[model samples]
Target: MAASSTATIGSYELTSRAIYEPPAAAVREGSRILDETRRLGSRYGEDYSDGGVESVAAQNASAELAESWKYPRQNVFRTGAAFWSLLTSGANDAAYGALIPYLEEYYNLSYIIVSLVFLSPFVGYILAAVLNNTLHRRIGQRGIGITCGICHILAYIIIAVHPPYPVLVLAYCLAGFGNGISDAAWNAWIGNLDRANETLGFLHAFYGVGGVISPLIATNMIAKADLPWYTFYYVMIGLATIELVSCTWAFWPNGPEVYRQTMDASNEDNQGMKEALFKLPFARVTWLCAAFLLCYVGVEVSVCGWIVQFMIRVRKAENYPAGMTSMGFWLGLAVGRAVLGFVTPLLGVKVAVSVKILARLLEGSLAAFGGSGAAILPFAVGAIAQAKGVKTLQPIILAFLTALLGLWLCLPRIGRKQD
Candidate 1:
C-alpha cells in the first residue's frame, strides 16, 4: 500500500511539472513576439508602458517624440496644400487686366484713372506691411488667412456689381489688402516650415501658376460674352470662399504662429521689427526680393496688361487678337515660372534672380529695338539655356550683365559680403 501511494504522488508531481514548463518552440516564439512589440513601441510609441510612467524625464522624452512625429508630417502636407490654395487665390488677379477694357468702355475712365485703378493695390500692400506683424500676432496665421479670404470675396463681389468708380477703387484696394495680408502671413508661415527655402520656391511657383490661369479665364469669359463682365467677380468670389474654408479646416490650431514666434525671437532678439526691417542683413535680402518682385511684376504686367494694345496698335503681329496676346503672355509667364521652379534650386536664388532680371532687360531692349520677334528670341534663348546650359560667350556675357545689375541694386542697401 505504501509503495502504491508513493508512485501516485510521484506521477502527479511529474504531470504538474510538464504542464508548467512550456516547449522550446513555444518559448522562442513568445520571446520573439515580446521583442517585436517592444521594438515597435519604441519606434512608434504604440506601447503605453513607458508613456504611462510618471516621471519628468519620461514626459519630456514623450513630448519631444510627439513633436517629432507631428511637424514633419504636417509640414509635408501643409507645404503642398498651402501652395495650391495660394495659387487659386492669386489666379483671381488676372481679372484686373480684363477690368481695364470694361472701365474704359463703360465708365469712360481716362488713362490716369485706369492707371490709378491698377496702382491702388500698391497702397494696400504698403498698408498691410505696416500692420502685418501685429495682425498676425493678434489673430494667428489661420485666423488672418480666413479674414483675408473673407475680404477678398467681398471685394470681388463689390467690383462685380459695378460699383461707382470711387467704390471700384475701394474694392480694388480691399482686394489688395487681402492679397497683402495673405502674402505676408502665409509667407511667414511657409518660412517657418522645415526646408523653408525649397518650400518657399514651390509655394511661389503656385502663385505663378495662378497668375497664368487668371488671364486665360478672364479673357475667355469676356470673349464668349457668356455673362456680363461683372460675372467674373462671382467666379472670384467662389474661389475666395473655397480659400476661406480651406484656411479654416486645414490650417487650424495655428501651429504656424508658434513656429514664427520662435524664429523671430531667435533671429531678432535685440532688434525691433522696424529696425530689423532696415538692418543690413534684412535690407540686403529685402532689396533682392524687391528687385526680383519689381522686375517680375513690371514684365508680367506689361506683357499681360499692354501686350494686346501693343500687338494691335504697334507690332500688328500675325494672329494677334485682342485676347490672344494676353493669353500668350500668361502662357509664357506660367511656363517661365514652372521652369524656374526646377531651375532656381540648381542655380541658387541669387543667380536665378540675376538671370531673370537680365532676361527682362534683354527682352525689353529687344522689344524697343527689333520689335516683338527679336524680343521673343532673347526670352526663348534664356528659357532654353536655363535647362540646357549656355554653350557660347553670348549667354555668359548676358549672365554677367545680369549679375552686375543685381549687385548695383543690392549695393546701395547693403555692402557686398566678404567672400
Candidate 2:
C-alpha cells in the first residue's frame, strides 16, 4: 500500500498520502444502526447527549420510531432539502470568507471587528447545541428548518441593504443561529435514515458544491460585476427564499408537528442530557471529537476564509481571477469527497515514499474530504506565490503549515505503524 500517489496538476505533483483502514463494526454494520444504538443505549446511552443515540429510549425505541416520518416521498424530500440547506450554508460560509477583505474596506474597521462576522455564527451553533433536544421535541424538526430558512432570509436582507456596521454584525449573528439549529437537526435526522452514511456523504458533498460556487459568484460581484457589491447578497436572498419554501414543503408534513421521537416526558430527556455531560468516558470522547473538529474547521474556514485576500496581497492576482483560486480549493474538496468516497474501500491504508506529506492526506480520501481539500490546494498555490514575486507566498505557506501541524498534533498516530 503505497499511501503516497502523485497526480500531476501542471508541474507540481499533487502527491496525497493516505493510510486506509477498513471500517469498524459500527460503520460496517450499516443497517443495524438503531439496533446497535439500542444496545449501546441500554448501557450508557443516556450519557450520549446533544440529541444523539444516548436517550432513555422513549418507547424502547429510537427517533426512527416515529411512524409519521416514514413517508417515502417525505424522506426523500427531507434528505434533499437538508442537502440544499447545507449547500446554501456552505456558500455563505465561503462567500463571507471571500468577502472579508471587502467587508473590512466597506466597514472601515480593523481585523478584529470584521472578524466578529465569523464569530457571531458560533453564537448560533452554541445555542443550537444547548437547545436542540428540547426544541426539536417541542417545535419539530420541520419548524426548526423553517425557522432556519427565515433566519437566513432575514440575514441576507439585512446584508443586502448595507445597514450600519453594528446592524450587519447582528444580522450575521442571527443567520448563524439559524445555521446552527438547521445543521444539528438535519444531521440528526439524516443519521437515522436508510443508507445513513451515504446520505450523510451527499449532505456534505452539496456543502462542498456550495463552497465551490460561492466564491465564483461572490468574487465576480465584488471584484467584477457592475451591479452593487451588495448584489451578491440579493442573489443569496433569492436562494434563501427558495430554501424557505423547500424546507416548509419537505419538513412541514402537511402542517403536522410530528417530530417527537417518543411520548416520553420532557424532564426525563433533560436528565439524559445531564447524565451524558457528567459521565467521564463519554465526556472525554465527546470533547476530543470536538477538539479535532475545532482544528479541522479552523483549517477549512481559515483557508477558504482567507485565500482571496491571500491571492490579492501575495500574488497580486486580479480580483476576478484570484477568486478562482479559492474556487479551485473547494472544488477539489467536493471532488475529493465524492471520488475518494467511492474508492477508499478498494485499497487498504498504505505508505508513500517521498517528502513528508500532510498527515490528514495520508489518512485517506474520506479523510481528505472533511476539510483537507479546503486547506491543501489553495495553500499550495500560496507556496508558489513567492516564486513569482520574491517571497510573497509566506502568508499562505504559514497558514497551511499551521493546518498540517494541527492535524498532526490532534492525530499523532496518522501514517505511523501500529506497535
Candidate 3:
C-alpha cells in the first residue's frame, strides 16, 4: 500500500511538471509565432493610441517613415514629372526676359504699357496660393497636374495666336496660376523626402537649366531664324503637353481617397495655414522666410527680366549677344545649384548661407537687394524712364539696393539677443 501511494504521488508530480514547463521545441515555435503576430500588427496597426499596456505591442508600428525615391518605385517618375514642370516654368519665365524687347516693338507700346504682362501674373499667383490647400483636399495631386497642364496649354495657345495687349496680359495670368500650382505642390512633395536639400537643389537647378536653354532658343529663333515672337510659344505648348501627360500618369494612384488615408495617419496635416502662420515661433520663421524669398525672387526676376533690354538699350549690344548674357546668368545659377547641393550639407546650412551672403556682398553690394519698393518699381521706373530715358535703369537699380538695406534693418528680429 505504501509503495502504491508513493508511485501515484510520483506520477502526479511528473504530470504537474510537464504542464507547467513546455518542451523546448514548443517554446521556440510559440516565440516564432508571437514575433510574426507583432510584425503583422505593427505593419497594419491603427494610429497608435496610447492605451498603456495594450499599445506596447503596436508601439513600433505607428512611426511615419520618410519616403524615398526607391521604396515607392513610382516616386522616380513623380520626381521626373516635377523636374519637368519646373523646367517648363523656367522656360516660360526666361522667355519673358528675352522677349520683352520684341513685345514692346510688336505692340508699339512704351515700357510702362508692356510691363503690364509682368504685373498681371501676380493676380493668378495670389489666387493659386489661396486655393492650393482646397484643391489638394478635394481633387488631390492628380487634379493639380491636370489643372496646371490645362492652364499652361491654354495660355501658351493664346500667346501663340498674338492676341491684343489686354488679352495677352490675361493669358499670362492664367499661365502664372499654373506655374504657381506646380511650384507649390512639387516643392512640398519633394521637400518631405529623404535628403530634401540635395533634391530641392537639383530641382531648382532644372529651373535654371530651363532658364539657360530658353533664352538661347528664343534668341536664335528671333535673331538667327527670323521667326516671329509668337513662334517661341509653339515650343512651350509641346513642353506643357508633355508635362500634362507625365504628371497625370505618375500621380494617378494618388487620388483623394489615398490622400485622405495618408492624412488621417499623420497629425501634421490637421493644422490650417492660418493656424500655421499664427503659431508663435513657427510664425516668426515663416514670415522671415517669406520676406527673404520675396526679396530674393524679386531680385532674380528683375535682373533676368530686364537684363536683355538693358544690354540692348544701355550697353548697345547686338540682339544675339544681349540674349546670350541672360543665358550666361542662368548657366551660373544652374551650376551653383548642382555643385552646392553636395557642398552645402558638408558646410552646414547656416555656414553656407553666411558664405553666400559674404560672397554676394563682395561681388555687387546691391545686386540682390529688394523689397515692396522694388516690387512697385515698374511703375516708379516707368515714370522716371519717361523723364530720363532708359539711363534710369541704373539709378532705379541703385535705389532698390538702398531700399533693400533699409528693409534688412527693419526686418523682424529673429534669434538676436534683446538689450
Candidate 4:
C-alpha cells in the first residue's frame, strides 16, 4: 500500500511505510508493524481500530497512527514549559498564602472580603471544568496559555500599584480564572503525553519547589528592606512579566487545530460539561485530589507561614534565626519530596507511606517526650510541653503530623498507573 492511501482517525492521518521485500523481510516487517499498531491503539484508543482492519484499512490506520505519535512529544514539551513557567510566575503565592496578609495590611480588607479572595480560586477551578474544552476549541491551548499569562501579569501589576480593595478583588478573580483555565488545559495536555506519570511527578515537584521558594523570597526581602508591603508585589509583578514573555514566545502562531483535535465522540453519560467533569469514576478522583490539595496546602502553609513567628515567640530558639527557620521548613519539604521520588518507586508507594507514618510516629513521640533538645532531630516537629523550654517541640510535632497526613493521603495510588 502507498502511504498516501490512508485514512484519518481522530487527529492522526494514517499511512503505510512498508517497502517491498523478500518473504523473510516481509514477515519480519509485518510482525513489527502489527506490534507497533497494537501499542499505538492501546495508548490512544480513540484514534485507531476497535476491530481488526482489512489490508486497506490497516495501511490507512498505520499512517494515522504514525501521525498521532508526534503529538505526545509536543504535549510533553509544552506541559513541561507551562509547569516551569507557573512556578517562576509567583502567582501561586498571591492566591495561596500571601493574600490574607496582603489584604489585611495593604487594603485593610474585612474578614468577609478576605474569605472571598481565598475562596474565589476554587470557584474558578470548578468553572474551568466547564470552560476548558470550549476555550481549547475557540482559542487553542497555546492561545489560552498566552492569554492566561497576560492575565497573571496584569493582576500582579494591579496589586503592585495598590488598587482599591474592590479592584484588587476583581484582579484576583481574573488571576483565578487564568490559573484555573491554564491548570485544566495543561493537566489534560500533559495527561495525554508520553511517559505521563513521570512527567506529572516532575511537574508537581516543580510546583512544590515554587511553593517552597516563594515564601522564602518574600520573607527575605521584607526582612532586609524598609519598604511597605508593595515591594513583594513588585517582585511578583517582575516574575509574572517573565512568565508572560516566556509563554508568548513558546506558543507563537496559536490556533486550536494546530495542537489538539476536537473530541466529537458522543457519550451517554457525558451529556453536558458539568456531567462530564463531576460525574462517575472521575468525581471520586477529583474529590480525592481536592482533599489531598487542601491537606497539603494547609500543612505546607502552616509550617512555612507560621514557623518563624512560632520560633521567635514560643520556642525562643535564638540559634536558628526566623529566615533560617522558614528556610528549614521549605528545605525539609524539598528533601522529603526528593526522597519520596527516589524511594517511592524502589520500595513502592505503600511501603513508602508505611515508612513515613512510622517515622513520623517515632519523631512525634520523641518530641513529645524528649523535650526542647528534640529540635535537633532531622525532621521538624511541633509539640507543646508543660515546661518552660519544651514549647520548641510543637513545630516539630506539627511537621511530623503533616508528613504523616501527606503520606497517608498519597498511599492509595502511589504506585498505580493512571487511567
Candidate 5:
C-alpha cells in the first residue's frame, strides 16, 4: 500500500513537470518540425534556389510546414488586416473628437482634466514602446491586439454612460493606452512589408475615410437632432468590435511563428539591429524621422481639434456648417493619401516615406501658422478700417475676398494651360 501511494505522488509530480516544460519527446518533436527551416535559413538564406538539390529539398520541407500551419500565403493577410484596423482607428477619432464640447459640458470638464486626458495616452505610448516587443515575442501579435481591444471596450462603454469626471479621465487614459499599443503593433507589423510605404498610404487613406464619415454621423445627430453626445460612443463600440475581430482572426494560430521566421530571415546578415542602428548615418536619419513625426502630429492634431471653433466664431457659422467644414478638411486628407499611395512605389519606399512625411509637416505647419496669422490679420484689417473712420469693413472684406477668389480660380487654369 505504501509503495502504491509513492507511485501516485510520483505520477502527479511528473504531470506537473510536463505541464511546464513538456516531456523531452515532445520537445524533440517540436524541434524536428522546425529543423528543416533552421537548416534552410542557416545554409542558403530565405531564397536559396540556386538549382541545388539540397536547397530544393529544404524549400519543399519548409513549404509543407507552412501549409500544415495554416499560414500558406503570408504576405497577403497582414496588410489587409492593418488597413481595416486603421480604418477603425480613424473612425473612433472622428466620433470622439467631434463631440468634445458636449463631453466637456456634461462632465464639467476643467482645463487640467483636458490636459490629463491628452497626456495619459502618451504615457501609454511610452509603455507600449517599451513592452511591445517582449510581449509580442511571448504572446504573439494577436495576443497584444486582444488586450488593446479589451481596453477600448472598457473605455468607450465608460464614456457612453457619461461617467463621473474622474472616471471619464480614467476612461480616456484607458482609451489612449489601448490606442498606443495597437498603433505600435500595427506600425511594427506593417513596417516590415516589402512595399511598406505603399501599404502604409492605403492604410492611412482609410483613416481619412473614418475621419470624414465618423464626424458626419456625429454632427448630424448632435448638431441637427441634439442627441446626447454620449450616444456617439455606440458607433465607436461597433467600430472597435470590428477591429478587434479582424485582427484576432487574421493573426491567430501562427502569427508568432511567422514573426519568428521573418525576423530570423531578415536579421541573418545585419549583425544585430542595435549594432546597425548605432552605426553612423542611419542613427542620424532615424532621429530626423522621429523629430519630423513629432512636429507633424502636434500641428495636425491641434488644427483638427480647434478648427471647428475657428469656423463657428470667426466665420459666424452655425454648428452644422462648422462641422461640415471639418469634414471637408478630412476628405482632402483621404483623397491625398489615396492619390499619393501610387506615387510611393515610384519613389522607392525609404525616400517616399521621408518625403511624404516632410510634405505633411510642411502642409500642416503652413496651415496652422498661416491660420494663426489669419486669425490675427482680420482683426488688424478691422483695426485699420476703424482707424480710417470707415463705417463698414465690407469693402475691405470684399477686396480681400476678390483677390483670394481670383487666386483660387486662376492658378489651376494657368498651370493646365502651361502644361
Candidate 6:
C-alpha cells in the first residue's frame, strides 16, 4: 500500500506515519482526532479485513498530541519560566495575609477598609478573563509573558513607594491582572504535556512553595526587623524583573503566527469559547468545574488572606505563630498536590476530585478552627468578618466546602462515548 493510498473509514484519511510510528502516539492522536470528529457528528464503525489493518489504523499526523518536555527541548526553559511565574504569584498572595496586621497599624485603617485590597483585585481578574482570547489572538504567549511581567513589576514598584490607600488598591489590581494572565496562559500550556496531571501537580506545588515561604519572609521583615510594610514589595519587584526576562526569552519563538498555526485556527469546525461553554457534556463539566473552583479558591485564599487575622484576634496568637498558620496551610496544599498527582490517574478525575473536596470539608468541619472568585468570596468573607467576627470564618469555610463537594458530584464525566 502506497503511503498516500485512501482507506475510507468514516470520512478520515489514513497516512503512512500512523503505520510507521509507535502505536502509542498513533493511538493517542487517533483518539483525539476521533473525538473532534464525533464533536462534528461523524459516525464511525466500519469493518476492514485483517490485510487492511494498517490502512484502518492510519490517521491525520498533523493533529496535535500530548507532548513531553524534551521533545521540543526549548520547552524545558519555557516550563521553568512558568514555574517561576507561579511562584511569584504564590508569594504575592501569601504575603498579604502576613502583612494585614502591619497594613492596619501603618495606615490606621479598619478591617473592611483594608479588605478593599483583596476586593480590588477582583476587577483585574474579571477584565483578564474577558480580554484573554483577544490578547491571545493579537500577541500570542510572548506578548502575554511580557505584559504580565510588566504588570507585576509596575505593581510592585507602586507598592514599594508606600502610596495612599486608593493608590495601593490600584497597585493590587495591576498585580492581580498580571497574576490572572500568567495563571491562564501557563495552565493551558502545561495542560498539553504528557501526564499533565503529574506535571501540573509539580507546577502548582511550586505555588505552594511560594505560599509557604512568603509569609515567613514577610513576617520576619516586619515583626523581627521592624521594617516598613512596603519593603517586602521591593523583593517582589526583583522577582518580577527575573520573570520578565526569563519568560520573554523562552517564548520569543512562539509569537502570534506560530500560535495560530499550532491551534489550527484556519479549521472551519474548530470549537470556540461559545461552543465549549454550550456543548453537551463539555457544558455540564465546564459549569460544574467553574462553580466548584469559585467555591474552592474562595476558601483557599480567604483562609490565606484572613487566617492570620483570625488567629491574632480570636486565638490570641502572636505575629510569628499567626503567620505560621498560613504557612502550614500552604505546606499541606503543596505536599498534597505533589503526592496526589501520582495517585489521581489511578483514581480517575471524578473520584479524585470527590475525595479532595470531601477531605477539605472534613478538615473545615473539624477545625471549629479553620479556615475568592479568584476574589469575591474572600472579599465577602472579609466583609462578613467586619460585621460578625473572624471566628465566623469557621462556619463559612464549612459551608463553602460543603458546596464544593456538591459541585463536584454534579460534574458530568466527559469521556469518549460510543455512538
Which of the numbered candidates is closest to the native, going by highest lDDT? 6
lDDT of 1 by residue, 1-419 (tens): 89999999999999997886666676666666545543222322222232222455664465455422136576544555466666765575555555566666778865445555656666666667666656656777677768788888888889888988899888877877777777666665554433344555666667767766676667677756555667777778887887778776666767557646764755643353334247666456544554445444444553455444334444555322565666556566666655654655464445534333322222112111211221222233334434553233245445645764775666433223410
Better of 2 and 6 by TM-score: 6
Q: Which lDDT value does model 3 have at 418?
A: 27
The number of residue pairs in model 3 that clash at the backbone is 0
188-259, model 3: which lDDT tens digit per residue?
677556566688788889988999999999999999999999999999999999999999999888887776
Candidates in descending lDDT order: 6, 3, 2, 5, 1, 4
Candidate 4's C-alpha runs over 4 A off are 1-80, 89-91, 94-117, 258-262, 265-286, 298-327, 334-419
In model 1, the runs with Cα more than 4 Å from the true position are: 1-71, 255-285, 315-320, 347-419
Tens digit per residue, CA lDDT, model 2, 252-283? 86232455434252234445434434566434
| Per-residue accuracy of model 5 over 1-419 as CA lDDT, tens digit each | 89999999999999986776555665566566446445333332332232113466675565455321123464466566666666765665555446655665777654334434444445555555556556666777878668777778788899899877778767866776666666666655554443445666777788788788887988988988889888888888887787778778777764566656665675642353343246555445444444434444434443444455456545777878778877887788888987886775664434544443323222222222222222232333334533552223345545555554544443221222332
Candidate 2's displacement at residue 161, Å, is 0.4
- Measured by TM-score, the strongest candidate is 6
Q: Which model is ahead, 2 or 5, in terms of lDDT?
A: 2
Per candidate, the number of residue pairs that clash is: 0, 9, 0, 16, 0, 3
Task: Compute the lDDT of residue 214 as modeled in candidate 1.
Answer: 71
lDDT of 3: 0.72
Cα lDDT tens digits for candidate 4, 1-419:
34444434321522222222234554566566666545433322122222233465655565454422145355434655677665653235322343344455566654334444544444444555456656767888667768777777787788778777777767766676666666555545544444333454555466557666766666555545545555676766676676667666655555787544434432321253344236765345434444444445544544554455456557665423554666556556655654554544464444433333222222111111221111112112221222333345465556656765765665345444422
Q: Which ranges of candidate 5 are over 4 A from the true structure?
A: 1-78, 110-112, 255-257, 264-272, 275-277, 348-419
Error of 5 at 255 (Å): 4.2
lDDT of 6 by residue, 1-419 (tens): 44444444422534554554446655566666666543332344222221223222233222232255544789889999999998898888888789988898889988888888888777777767666656776899999999999999999999999999899999999998888778777776776555656777888898889899899888888888888879999889988999999999999888888767765644532353344457776456555666666677778988888999999999999988898899999999889888877877675545544333322222111111111364677778878888998898889999988888888878755452321
What is the Cα-based lDDT of residue 177 in candidate 4?
64
